[model samples]
Target: MPSSLTPPPVQASFGDTDVYLFREGTHAQLYRRLGAQLSPGGEGASFGVWAPNATEVAVIGDWNHWSDLADPMRARADGSGIWQAHCPSARHGQAYKYRIRTRNGDVLEKADPFAFLAEEPPATASRIWTLEYDWQDAHWMGTRGAANALDAPMSTYEVHAGSWRRKDGQFMNYRELAHALADYVAGLGFTHVELMPVTEHPFYGSWGYQTTGYFAPTARYGTPQDFMYFVDHLHQRGIGVLLDWVPSHFPTDAHGLAHFDGTQLYEHADPRQGFHPEWNSAIFNYGRHEVRSFLISSALFWLDHYHLDGLRVDAVASMLYLDYARKHGEWIPNVHGGRENLEAIDFLQELNRACYRDHPDTFTVAEESTAWPKVSRPIEMGGLGFGLKWNMGWMHDTLAYMREETVHRRWHHDRITFSMVYAFHENFVLPLSHDEVVYGKGSLINKMPGDSWQQFANLRLMLAYMWAHPGKKLLFMGGEFAQRREWTHEGELEWWMTDQPEHRGMQLLVGELNKQLRGEAALHQLDFDEAGFEWVDANDRDNSVLAFLRKSRDGQAVLVVCNLTPVPRQNHCLGVPLSGTWREILNSDAKPFGGSGWGNLGEVRTAPLAANGHRHALYLTLPPLSTLYLKRDADV
Candidate 1:
């Protein structure tokens, strides 16, 4: 049984200009017109959808008792395949779906692609919700350009909101998590917090990567307004927010974008081009004009509505190659007969252009693994336009080298120094991200090859080296305090580990590293320029030692020395650029950092003896498995 009320008169929402831009694939604000939006007077809601192949479409919702025949929509005469309807009884806070009658007489129910809010997982319906928030981050908005500058000190704390922390083993609301995360991140002195995808997805295991709702945030935490509060609160605390966005592939869920209007409207019809073999998902058809508009709109939607600081695009390598995970006969070459995905490349360039053109203060990062050229360069430079690219080569090489026994590390000494050959290839972010700690990979502390004490020492040394390396820094959530196990979405982090002395020391070391990274101009002011780095000593393979200098634009310098072996070295002479008192700014082997307390007694003076191509040298005692930072005293 259905209500006998007559449907409201058809009110067209899309004008000629919107249609032209939408068809031309340049519409960046489709959310304003395509989704279920309430009228100005709050009387009823207007709906618009694109189903060119459908014979009939209707609005089915709680207001009409989920009736398919109660309200029928009209197709535009312009043959743009757009369907429109107005339901006087439909109001805000109601669940709805489109009942589309296919051309061959089949009925399909699909959720709104531009939905602002969606029902929690296991209930696949879109909720008609408004995005009205009273933001109090004007100060952050007006001045974030400086905080997000290329020369700024940028260290990110990567978090998965569902598993970051919980209350009584239950998920915390966005408002509650906002305060908790802001306090913790601000205390650690990280400039930004990069959240694993928050876009709505049906499977929690995918961690928001297999996204279904492009324009909506998962209701598992809270409403759209609640998520807004999360960003606002972080900004007020002087912390920026970056979201992980996935446009590489999508799940083939029935109610999702797959087979919309009884056709492959959003994806490729051919299996070779549409299918993702590894994930068993459907790849997007970037060549389609309307699909391009949809994806670019989704990317800008976050920056426009949520006031986010940036987007870290996930699995960009998958999108750039046609033969990404395919065999020889299982792929299609571009029109130029090459392996490059030309259409996707164009889409990426256009996406970056739109994001920067609309929101100049925000940035976009690429998680590209291959040796793609100039990923972080500008579009005019004939490269993929991104603000930063993850240094996957550095992460893999360093971790592989650390996993080997200390006795065998000297043979692989090139692993630690090879990154310097192409260190300045692109604006890189040295990321120790969640990918390293998942599956059977083990935790960061356990990755070090040594006894308990030596393992902790090695971990500390690695952190110091990463901070002094030639790029920005990113560490996953549990790595800050050395969570003992691999990461799983089903459980929260091991918060009790912080109570232990060894784990607490790791936490303290991270905070100190971040403090020094922010406080010392020589550490971060010229992270991307080779001019900021110099090899003080790189040929000490027998000692398994390495040293380098990080300099600022003003010639201020900090020398970093690493002793990888377990045996201490006494009277080790290291060359210096200046003859003055070198103050020990940081030592990973200090007693407070859960070490054996072997160091150079806080200071060392240079002598006239030449070593390592320098006119002056300093005699020092290097601790076991330690990395130290020494800066020349300006007042001396």
Candidate 2:
């Protein structure tokens, strides 16, 4: 249930059920009864926090004049390690922190780990807020259960809200983004918009990855209600919303989770297992029952309170590996002397199971970059139970191949075809995410090896190939319009790039790619099955050309040919199953896409000549540095 409709009782007290569930790691609605809830009497608020190590705890805020001696909390009689206090003066909208006296005699002030709101960054006080909103997205929520299925057409527009677009050099608020961002993404023809983390964090540079408030939507945009409006508006516009969820590690800020109550309650006490050296953060103690409940409650809060369509979990690879980013002596092995983090694996399994059990319409995706098997498989089959997994191997290999000079591309042709080796192993999302466009890596367009004209041409070919490939699609903001500069969290995307014809043409190509991807059943219906794709001529390395066929479940098919070289092939012959004319559906070399205007014009006829083991062949003109999509005549 949403917390907005489930406030605590007037004289709330912890019960045995709460204690049992918390200890058993089954407390999905802990956010509702815990945290600061308004008193049923409407006098003030009831504050509760789990701080077993604290010898004493108090609520300090503006209401108490930040006094450590005022509003002391009492330990629960159920022996649940929870402290609660009913303050008649600490009402809604007041900022507060828990002042705890540790066993070592040190006093510490910490923000509420389950706070529903927090003061914006540079200030670390948790605010008392009642979660309430008039949602208007029932139509979308009712029909979203099947929208993320394996066979559905899902082309996602990966966005960083604070930087997607700005007005007068300032971040756009959620209300403004609700309308503007929704309209823009809809026009681009993407079915979903995946926002970079919006959870409350202290630093803008972390891009919301280093979260401080798990339950609070970042005030960097607007209030929690405003964020509800953002999701609602996007849903109303027919765009599903996905949040970037970071459960791997959290920042070690002083007022944050680290060293709370002068003890490592949230993280493991061992540095080898608890501390993340690369991010300078703390890894959650997934083996702990209360900790698992806390994290699980956070995951459910977004879906229940804000009506989000899905969660794209970040750094899943880090969570799964015990030796991630560590030297030989710097890490500790699991109980079985293995490198896998067994506790995290169990937690993820439970998380996925809970998501499907509680909110069947919502999906979970893993940003896992490893060979961990069956990531998108079901939990019942010993798999991670994610709806989709990012195909990082494909992204890395394809980009590396594209960066090579065209004259040398033939030698590295395997990079283009190798992904198919494991294409069906897991349901994949071919992601060109924000990570690819930042941190000293050049923009997608800049990665192409060529002059201005050829750069745009290569980008067009890459996108067309992505759309026609065997997977769902995802592209980060600004990539569609060919932004010349690498992405930075500090500023918005270069919207002015669309003024140039080359940039405009690149954007147009992306839009058309999305349109075709959604309209053609052969492109998406059988994405995960071997029956959908058949290679026509994958061994044409010398000429830098490859051809394949994509088939829908209904027997509809589309033929795709790629010319990777700068020089055009006048009569490229490839086998076809149908004996009829194949009409050109999309060509990267079309003039409208800023190509060299060299193509088959519109259609090509098949010959009875045998080629590539097929009885029928098509001798067609293949354009340079382009990808062509051709649909066979239905009359055949």
Query: What are the lDDT figures for the candidates, one per model?
Result: 0.92, 0.90
Q: Write the per-residue lDDT of candidate 2 for residues 490-521, one digit (tens) a residue.
A: 88888888998889988888989989988999
Highest lDDT: give the candidate number: 1
lDDT of 2: 0.90
Off by over 4 Å in 1: 1-9
Residue pairs in clash, model 2: none
Return the lDDT, model 1, position 379: 95
The runs of at least 3 residues in candidate 2 whose Cα sits more than 4 Å from the true structure, single-residue gaps closed, are 1-10, 40-42
Q: Count the backbone clashes (under 3 Å) in each candidate.
A: 0, 0
What lDDT score goes with residue 260 in model 1?
Answer: 85
- Could you estimate the TM-score for every candidate? 0.98, 0.97
